[model samples]
Target: MNTVDALVQLSFQVQRILAEAGAEHDLSIVQLRLLGILRDRQPGMLELGQHLGLDKSSITGLVSRAEKRGLVERSPSPHDGRGVLVALTPAGRRLVEVGEAQINRRITELTKRLNATQRKQFTQLASVLVNT
Candidate 1:
């Protein structure tokens, strides 16, 4: 495969690994992503939609579902009285922790064949790609 094809295939492979990890925790990939993003900071619905590249309705539905599952909660934004912020609940944090551990293990297993230098190079390249 060419470089682009190889990168695409690698992307799919990584996504599969993440999907499997998310499945174990009963989360869709988007839901897992939401949890991951919420891990750092709570953001208003509009901001969350922007960060997730989702529309307002989609963000509303996603947050609603997560809230129903007790994984997340929506609160009145202190800075914006009319706006709501979405944040992970304590249960959500625990789930994310476990899900992350599973993803790390799966990724390690996938890359186990790579030598130390190759792994380092791969990490650097991935970082560059992500940053760009």
Candidate 2:
């Protein structure tokens, strides 16, 4: 496959592996990503959209859907009242923590599948990619 197609395939595999498994809770990958981003900062919608590579309207819609689930909230930014800040509610934090652990576990499991030489290559590549 071409590089773009390979990247797309990798993304699909990652989303499928980490996505919520039960009918009781359904969150899209974008929603999950937004939660992760919020875990770091209470970003304004504009900043959040930039982080998520989405438009403001799209981020707003995603936030609206997540808010309905009691997972996230919007408050006035401490630095700017006119600017709304998006943050994870306690439930959202729990969800993100769970997702993080799950992702880490899966990655570890996958990494262990590699032999020693391949494992070194993987780690080296990951460090460079992530640092970049």
RMSD in Å for all candidates: 1.2, 2.9
Cα shift from native, residue 117, model 2 (Å): 7.2
Off by over 4 Å in 2: 1-9, 20-24, 115-121
Kindly list the per-residue Cα lDDT of model 2 for residues 86-107, writing each as its tens digit. 8899998888887787778776
lDDT of 2 at 55: 87
Q: How do the residues 1-132 of candidate 1 rate in per-residue lDDT, one tens digit apiece?
A: 899999999889999998888888888999989999999999999999998999999999999999999999999999988999999999999998988888888899989999999999999999999999
How many collisions between residues are there in candidate 2? 0
Best TM-score among the predictions, by candidate number: 1
Clashes per candidate (backbone, < 3 Å): 0, 0
- Clash pairs, candidate 2, are none
Off by over 4 Å in 1: none
- Model 1, position 12, has a per-residue lDDT of 98
Q: Which pairs in model 1 have colliding backbones?
A: none
lDDT of 1 at 32: 88
Query: What is the TM-score of each predicted model, taking all chains together?
Result: 0.93, 0.78
